[model samples]
Target: MIVAKQKPIEEIIEEVKDSKKLLILGCNECVTVCEAGGKKEVAVLASALRMYFMNKGQEITIDEHTLERQCDHEYLEEIRGNIDQYDAVLSLACGVGVQFMAEKYFNIPILPGVDTCFMGATEERGVWSERCQGCGKCVLAKTGGICPVSRCAKRLFNGPCGGSTKGHCEINKDVVCGWQLIIDRLKELGKLDDYETLAPIKDWSTERAGGPRKVVREDLQA
Candidate 1:
C-alpha cells in the first residue's frame, strides 16, 4: 500500500488563506488505512481551519466530503455538481488523488493535505516502512522476496556493501542491513546458492529514460 503522512495544520491553512469557501476532500482507500487522509481526518482539518479563521475574525465556510476514490473518473464525477460551489479544494488523499482531482476539475485549485511518503506496508499500528521503489525492473526472484532497491539505503543490486556491521546498516544503527535480511531469508529456504549469481546492470532506459511511462493493454482496451 502507499503510505502518507498528514501535512501540518499551519501549512494547510497557508495554502487556502485567500479562500473563503473551501472543500476538504478525503479518500476511502489507501490513505484511510494509514490514518492520514480518511473521513475522520477531513472533519478534524475542517474544524481546525474554521477555528483558525474564526480566531482571526475572518469568516470562512468549509465543507467536508470523502470519495470512494479520487483517482477514478467515475468517483470524481460524483462531485462535479457541488465542487464548483467552493473556491478551492483540499484533497486529503495521496499525491495521485490530488493530481487526479486537479486534472478532472481544471477550474478549481486543488491542494494536497498529505505528503505521499512511500510505497510501503504497515509494520504496526503506527509504523509504516518502505518496501518498493517501483523501479519497473523487479529482481525479487533472486533475493528471496526481499526488495533491496528500497530497503537498502544504497540500493545495491548485489550487496552488503562493506559498510554493514553486525547485520545493521552503517547509515543508521536501527536499520537492519537489507542484504543480511535477504541472505537470511534465502538461507531459510535452502536457496543460499542463489546469492552467487550477480544481477545484470539495470537498463534504466527501459525503466525511466523517456518522459512519463505508460502501459497499454490492447486486451483490456475498448
Candidate 2:
C-alpha cells in the first residue's frame, strides 16, 4: 500500500488562487485506503476551498469527483467532458495520480493535494508504517518475511550489522534489528540454515536501472 498525507490547506489554496473554477479530484485506490484522498477527503477539501473563498468575499466554483483510479486511462477518460468545465484541477490522489492527470489533460494545470510518502501498511486506523522502498529487488523470501532494506537503517544485505546491540538497531533504540528478527523467525521455522547462504548482489539493471519498467502480456491483450 502507498501511504500519503494531505497537503496543507494553505498551500492548496495558493495553487488555485487565480482560478474561479476548480475541480477536486480523488482516487478510490491506495489513497482511499489510507484515508487521504477518498470521497470524504474530496468533500472536505472542496468545502474548505469554498469556505476560504467565501470568507474572502469572493465566490468560487468548485466541483468534487472521486475516480475509481486516476492512474488508469480508462477511469480518467470518464472525466474528459467534465474536466473541461473547470479552470484547474486539484488532485487529492497520490503523486502518480496527479502526474497521470497532467499527462492526460495537457492543457490544464493539475496540482497535487497530497505528498506521496512511502509503500507502507496500516498498523492500525490512522497509523501507517513504511514497509518497502520498492528498491526493484525483493529479498523477503530469504529474510523470513522481514525486510532489511526498508526497516534496517543500514540496509545491510547479510546483517544485523556490527552496529546492532542486543535485538535493537543502533541507529534507533526503538527499532528492532531487522536481521535479528529474521534469524529468530527462521529459527522458529527450523530454517535457520538458510542464513548461511549469502544473497547475490542485486542486478538493478534488470529492475529500475534501465528506466521506466513495463510488462506486456500478449495473452491479456485483446
Candidate 3:
C-alpha cells in the first residue's frame, strides 16, 4: 500500500486561503487506509478550514467530496462538470493522484493536502513501514520474499555491509539487517546454497534512472 500523511493545517490553509471557493477532495484508497485522506479526514479538514475563515469574519465556500480513487480516469471523470465551480481543489490523495488530477484538469489548480510517503504496509494501528520500491524487476524469489531494495538502508543487492552487527543494521541499531533476515529465511527454507551464487550487477535503468515507468498489458487493453 502507498502510505501518506496529512500536511499541517497551517500549510494547507496557506494553499487555498486566497480562494473564494475551494474543494476538499479525498480518496477512498490507500490514503484512506492510512488515515491521511478519507471521507472522515475530508470532513475534519474542511470543518477546520471553515472554522478558521469564520473566525476572521469572512465566509468561503468549501465543498467536500470523496472519490473512489483519484488516480483512475474513470473516477476522476465523475467530477468533470462540478470541478469548475471551485476556485481550487485540495486533493487528499497520494502524489500520483494529485498530479493525475492536474493533468486531467489542466486549467484548474489541484493542490496536494497530504505528503505521499512510500509503498509500505500497516505494521500496527497507526504505524506504517516501507516494504517495496517497485524497482520494475522483482527478486523476492531468491531473497526469500524479503525485499532488500526497501528493507536495506543501502538497498544492497549482494549481502549485508561489514558494519552490520548481531543482525542489526549499520545505519541504526533499531533497524534489523535486511540481509540477515534474508539469510535466516533462506536457511529455514534450506536454500542457503543460493547465497553462494554471485548476484549480477543490478540494472538501475529499470528504475527511476530511465525516468517515468509504465506497464501496458497488450491483452488487457480494450
Candidate 4:
C-alpha cells in the first residue's frame, strides 16, 4: 500500500488561512489505511481549523468531504457542481491523489494535506515498513521473497556484504541485513545453490530513475 503521513496542522492552517472558503477533502484509500487521511481525520482537522479560525475572529466557510478515492475521475466528479463554493481544496490524500485532483480541476487550487511516504506494508497497528520500490522489475524469484532494494543498506544483490555481521546491518545493529534474510529463505527452500549465481549489473532505467512511469493495459481499455 502507499503510505502517507499527515502534515502538521500549523502548516496546514498557514496554507488555507488566507482563503475565505476551504474544503478538507479526504480519500478512503491508501491514506485511510495508514490513518493519515480518512473520513474521521477530515472531521477532526475540520474541527481544529474551525476552532483556530473562530478564535482568530475569522469566519471562513470550511466544509468536510470524503470520496471513495481521490485518484478516480468518477469519484472526483461528484464534487464538480459544488466545488465552486470553496476557494481551495485541502486534499488529505497521497501525492498521487493530490495531483490527480489538481489535474481534474485545473481551475481550482488543490493543496496537499499529507506527505506521501512510500509503497510499504503495515508491520502492525501504527507501524509500517517499506517493502517495495516498484522497480518495474521483479527479482524476488531469484533472491527469495524479501526485497533487497528497499531493505538492504547497500542494495547488494548477490550476498551479504562485509558490513553485515550476524544477520545485522552495519548501518545500525537493529537493522537486519536484507541479504541475510534472502539467504536464509533460500536455505529453507533448498535453493541455497542459487546463492552462487552472479547477477548482472542492474538496468536502473526501469525504475524511478527512468522518470515518471506509466502502464496502460490494452485489454482493459475501451
Candidate 5:
C-alpha cells in the first residue's frame, strides 16, 4: 500500500488562510489505511481550520468532503456541481491525487495536505515500513521473497555489503542487513547455491530514472 504522512497543521493553515472558502478533501484509499487522509482526518482538520480562523476573528467557510478515491475520475466528478464554491481544495490524498485533481480542475488551486511516503505495509499498530520500490523487475523469486532494492540500505543485489556486521546494517544497528535476510531465507528453501549466481547488471532505465513510466493494458481498457 502507498503510505503517507500528514503535513503540519501550521503549514496547512498557511496554505489556505488567504482563501475565504476552503474545501478539505479526503481520500478513502491508501491514506485511509495509513490514518493520514481519511474521513475522520478530514473532519479533524476542517474543525481545526475553522477554529483557527474563528480565533482570529475571521469567518471562513470550511467544508469537508471525502471521496472513495480522489485518484479516480468517477469519484472526483462527484464535486463537479459545487467545486467553484471554494477558493481552493486542500486535498488530503497522496501527491498523485493532488496532481490528478489539479489536472481535472485546471483553474482551481489544488493544494497537497500530506507528504507521500513509499509503498509499504503495516508493521504494527501505528507503525509502517517500506516494502517495495517498484523497480520494474521482480527478483523475489531468486532472492527468497525479500526485496533487496527496498530493504537494503544500499540497494545491493549480490550479498551482504562489507559494511554489514552480524546481520545489522552499518547505517544503523537497528536496521537488519537486507542481504543477510536473503541468505537465511535461501538456506531455508535449500537454494543456497543460487547465492553464488550473480545477478546481471540492473537496467535502471526501466525505473523512474528513464522517465515517467506507464503500462497500458489493452485488455483492461475499454
Candidate 6:
C-alpha cells in the first residue's frame, strides 16, 4: 500500500488562506487506510480550517467531500458538476491523486494536504513500514522472499555489509540486517546453498531511475 501522512495544519491553512471558497477533498483509498486523508480526516481538517478563519473574524465557505478515489477519471467525473463552485481544492489524497486531480481540472488550483511517503505495509494500526520499492524487477525468488533492495540500509544487492554485526544493521541496532533475514529464511527453507550464487547486476533502467515507467496490457485495454 502507498503510505502518506497529513501535512501540518498550519501549512494547509496557508495554502488556501487567500481563497474565498474551498473544497476539502478526501480519498477513500490508501490514504484512508493509513488515516491520513479519509472521510474523518476531511471533516477534521475542514472543521479546523473553519475554526481558524472564524477566530480571525473572517468567514469562508469550506465544503467537505470524500471521493471513492481521486486517481481514476470515472470517479473524479462525479465532481465535475459541482467542482467549479469552489475557488480551489485542498486535496487530502496522496501526491498522485493531487496531481491527477490537477490534470483533470486544469483551471482550478489543486493543493496537496498530505506528503506521500512510500509503498509499505501496516505493521500495526498506526505504524507503517516500507516493504517494496517497486523496482520493476523481482529477486524474492532467490533471496528467500526477502528484498535486500528495499529492506537493506544500503540497498545491497548482495550483502549484510561489513557494517552488520550480530545480524543487526550497523546503521541502527534496532534494524535487522536484510541479508541476515534472507539467510535465516533461506536456512529455514533448506535453501542456504543458494547464497553461494551471486546476484546479477541489476538493470536499474527498469526502475524509476529510468524515469516514469508504465506497463500496458494490450488485452486489457478497451
lDDT of each: 0.92, 0.90, 0.94, 0.92, 0.94, 0.94
Query: Which RMSD does model 4 reach against the true structure?
Result: 1.2
The pairs that clash in candidate 5 are none
lDDT of 5 by residue, 1-222 (tens): 889999999999889989999999999999999999999999999998999999999989999999999989999999999999889999999999999999999999999999999999999979999999999988899899999999999999899889999999999999999999999999999999989999999989878898999999999999
Candidate 3's displacement at residue 142, Å, is 0.5
Screening candidate 2 with a backbone cut-off below 3 angstroms (N, C-alpha, C), the clashing residue pairs are none
Tens digits of per-residue lDDT for model 4, 162-219: 9999999999999999999999999999999888899888888999899999999999
- Give lDDT tens digits, candidate 6, residues 1-222: 889999999999889999999999999999999999999999999999999999997879999999999999999999999999999999999999999999999999999999999999999999998989999998999999999888899988876789989999999999889999999999999999889888889999999999999999999999
Which runs of model 6 end up more than 4 angstroms from their true locations?
none
**Candidate 2: segments with Cα more than 4 A from true spot:** 206-208
Clashing pairs in 4: none
lDDT of 4 at 166: 91
Return whichever of 1 and 2 wins on TM-score: 1
Candidate 5 global CA lDDT score: 0.94
What C-alpha lDDT does candidate 4 achieve relative to the native structure? 0.92
Q: Estimate each model's TM-score.
A: 0.97, 0.93, 0.97, 0.96, 0.97, 0.97
Regions of model 1 farther than 4 Å from truth: 206-209
User: Lowest lDDT 10-mer window, candidate 5?
Assistant: 201-210
Collision pairs in model 6: none
Model 6 lDDT, full chain set: 0.94
In candidate 1, residue 99 scores what lDDT?
Answer: 99
lDDT (Cα, tens digit) per residue for candidate 3, span 1-222:
899999999999999889899999999999999999999999999999999999987779999999999999999999998888888999999999999999999999999999999999999999999999989899999898899898899999888889789999988899999999999999999999887777898898889998999988999999
Candidate 3's displacement at residue 215, Å, is 1.4
